[model samples]
Target chain A: MVLVAIILSACAPGTPDEDSWRVDALRSIGDVSSSVSSVQLALQHHDRLFGPYLQTVAVQAEDAAGTASTKLSAVQPPEPYQGRSDTVTSALDDAESLLTDARIAVVRRDSAAYADLVRRLKRTGDRLSRIEDRIRALPDDRSRP
Target chain B: MKKLLNVALGVLTAIGGFVDIGDLVTNAQVGARFGLSLAWVTLLGVVGIIVFAEMSGRIAAVSGRATFDLVRERLGPAMGMANLLGSMGVTLLTYVAEIGGVALAFQLICGVDYLLLFPFVGALVWLVLWRAKFSVIENLFGLLGLALIVFVVALLKLGPDWSQLGHSAVSFQPPKPEAWSTWAYYAVALFGAAMTPYEVFFFSSGGVEEKWGVKDIGVMRTNVLLGFPLGGVLSVAIAACTYVVFNPLSASVDTLGQVGLPVAIALGKIGLAIALLGFVAATFGAACETGLSTGYSIAQYFGWQWGKFVRTDVAARFHLVLLLSTVIALGVLATGIDPVQVTEASVVFSALALPLTYFPILVVANDRDYMGEHVNGRVLNVLAMFFMVVLTVVALAAIPLMIWTRMGA
Candidate 1:
């Protein structure tokens, strides 16, 4: 419930412009965040069956992040938000790359790698959230009817 | 004194063996979504299975015929074939799910894909079925399966508000945003998991496999009466822990990792280690039972030489079916389908197959030719008939409710 609200309130501008790249970018960021956090929670408790559970979500995160990155790659941002959109897409790609690394670390029980990946995951998540915040601050896309 | 010890061990094994992948996963899922509101279904399932297990056990002890044998004798070949096919199909589906469950549990420990473990799990199960003495298999896994009690220990460690959880248990009202259909759907799933037909098939066939006679009825009754209700407590414990952790977040449990999270959150590392052990033992133990039950139902229906009492060569057809079924289970699980989803479908389908599997037990237990003086007495008759109605409703509504809820979303 908390996660859902975080994603929705972060992604929605009063109404998004049909062409608003910010909305698409923010939504992708939210998706990556949700998937990363789920994997992160499983990892923090990494010494147990959560590893197997991580194995389950690891595959899902891989698929979801792939789609999110592909969608973000297609987005051409609006005038003021173009730079923010580029950063968001780059952060998303990094996050996706890290999730794959985390799955391998989790499977291999590479605690050092798991530790490093988790730190990177947090930085990536924070980056996504900050971009979402900036997108949330933008005024409603006035072009939508 | 020796007989008393034997009875005690039997009951303990039953208690330990009762929680399988279906119970572990379904109970945790329901608890997260509905809190204690649906706990009654697990309890109801316990009492229901006990009532019928005693009857089936009685039939096996008195007549020395396992379930499908009498099912064929009483229900006739044609209708009995329908029963056999329905029950065996779901039982095979459940068999595949149990193999996947064991693989899932192993994955938790090693951080590997469950599919990678399927062949070894299936091969180990078949090897055990082929060579292990029946009593050794029954007692070993069932006893190890008791590691599931970690859920109860974790629940106490979590120290939830009992009065609030108790109120939800009493009210039977689902939390907001959950509709009645979804609740009813899980209720059926719980029912199917608890009273799953294979447990009985394994129980009665196990009675015959161990050569239970009138001499063993006392032991069998003691196990069902005392063991099953205690097993129900472990099922509730899984739900209680999940409710404490995931309910507030409105999280629906989808992964085995989520199921063990509450345990880790409560007791941390050591608790999770034990819970993972529980996961492996419960699922592996059930894999053996369901795998055997698959072979038991088919062999008995055809009147083939069966039971571990005979040499493998003497029971060649039975052993062959067991081999083929293991391969089939391996094939199904190797397809990359989720075992958790398979468990949900198996239990719901088990609900659909319940009456077919059980109605003959009720009939055979009552028949003078089969049971003689061992037939159900008056009070037991009243209770059995009442549950028949309840199980009938559960069976009729299971499919529609599953479809309406889209497998509980």
Candidate 2:
């Protein structure tokens, strides 16, 4: 309960130029959610060979990335990307749900379900990474006359 | 000579039974997270367990009453009931996790699904409780759990940078990328796992069941003081192995496989096999202890007969609770939850529930009416008071950290 409050209060209302940043944040969230799903799927198959090893790596990466996004979320919004903060927030919601689903699958031992969720999550991640990449490539609207 | 052997056996059982699934998982997790930075917590926990276990054993020796029995008489019904509920819940959840842990160990060794082994594991645990002699049950798994020494062996094989580990132990700072909240959270987990309530409940109750008297106090203290720190050594070895293997990579331990990975790396397949056996024996033994403890606390609270010293038909209700608790634990595991994760959560909850049990014990330990000459001295009193305060603060921080870290993410 307290965590939810912290996360909510930490998330400031999106500004105009924050659109691309928000998109990047949402995409990163999606990527992490997908990665968790993939690891969950691998674990479900009883493939002890590499499943746990992979999951360990994946979770570590996701945690690092999530921390980064949280930091990025604190930065000021850029111009031109202003109104899309809501879109980013909604994407974060989706990402959180995906991650939650992955956790549930792990607890339930539903490997098949985990695999399917991972595939969807990966696609979501790919889309987000692409969006993030595009945003990084975009010119600063603040400098635009 | 026979008496000497019995004492030796008793000490071994105490050590084997001391470190359960909770200790195994939490020690590994903390080792992976903080290296030896929080090793002090285990040392602190070892001292706490020894002090309380000795007090409980002494109380049972003097009064012929188990810990919970004294709890009810000392604290009255309302407060006793509250402690009973809290301790029983944490112990029972741990019981469930141990059952799962045993099955997971079987899965690792036999290449079969752990869920498939769950029923057999549950039945085997029940049978031991039903038919095995009290001393035999204590001696058998208690001695067999020595297989966990493989952890110590593995630690030797890994040959960690001793100076660095020593440095981390002395110069404690929360590791990089980890907030103080999370570091504090794992510390509470380690402390709670080491000083779990059931250990005291079982220790005191077992002393009474074995009919320990003043003469046995020496042996009991030996078991508490020596056996627990030895158990802590095993815990340190586990954490050290995990630290050497996982900490550098920034990997979190989420499964038993990860817990055993360091052993596997150090000692190869033989090491893995031994560690898995240790896991099974530790968890299986704990399943019996916690299963029995569930009944022990409740029956003692309500003034009912309990223990394997009595026949099944004699303590029907007590046996019924034992059977029911095992079944419920198995059912929870059958739902496919990771026993490792369940074990982690159980330890965390145990942290939350520590004070309820410890406070009453501290009070009872100080009471001359019960403890007589065995009552805590000034030094023991000061230490107990310090732990009580530490426990309270840890309990306060546990929930908030769990929330903030999303259960450590």
Best by TM-score: 1
Estimate, for each residue in B1-409, the C-alpha lDDT of model 2 and write its tens digit. Answer: 9667767777777777777888888888788878889999999999988878888888889888898898889989999998998899899899988888888777656646677898899999988877877777666778878889899999999899999889888867777656687788888889889989998888888888888888888878877777788889999999998888767645556666567777766776666677777888888888888888898998899999888888889889888888898889888988878787798888888888889988998888889998888888999889888888988987777777666654554
When summed lDDT is taken over every stretch of 10 residues in candidate 1 chain A, the lowest stretch is A11-20
Off by over 4 Å in 1: A1-40, A44-145
lDDT of 2: 0.75
Query: Taking the tens digit of each residue's C-alpha lDDT, what string does model 2 give over A58-131?
Result: 34334444554565566555655544444454555555556656645554556667557767666555555555
TM-score of chain B of each: 0.98, 0.96
Chain A superposition TM-score per model: 0.74, 0.53
Question: Model 1 chain B: which ten-residue window has the lowest total lDDT?
Answer: B248-257
Q: Is the docking of candidate 2 incorrect, acceptable, medium or high quality?
A: incorrect
The digit string of per-residue lDDT tens for model 1 on A1-145 reads: 2244346445544333434565566557656776676566666666654455567667756666777788877766666665666677778888888898987776676877777777777777677777666666565632221
Which tens-of-lDDT digit does each residue in B208-278 have in candidate 1?
98889998899899999999999999999999998988776444666676788888877877888888888
Question: If candidate 1 were superposed on the true structure by all CA atoms, what would the RMSD be?
Answer: 7.6
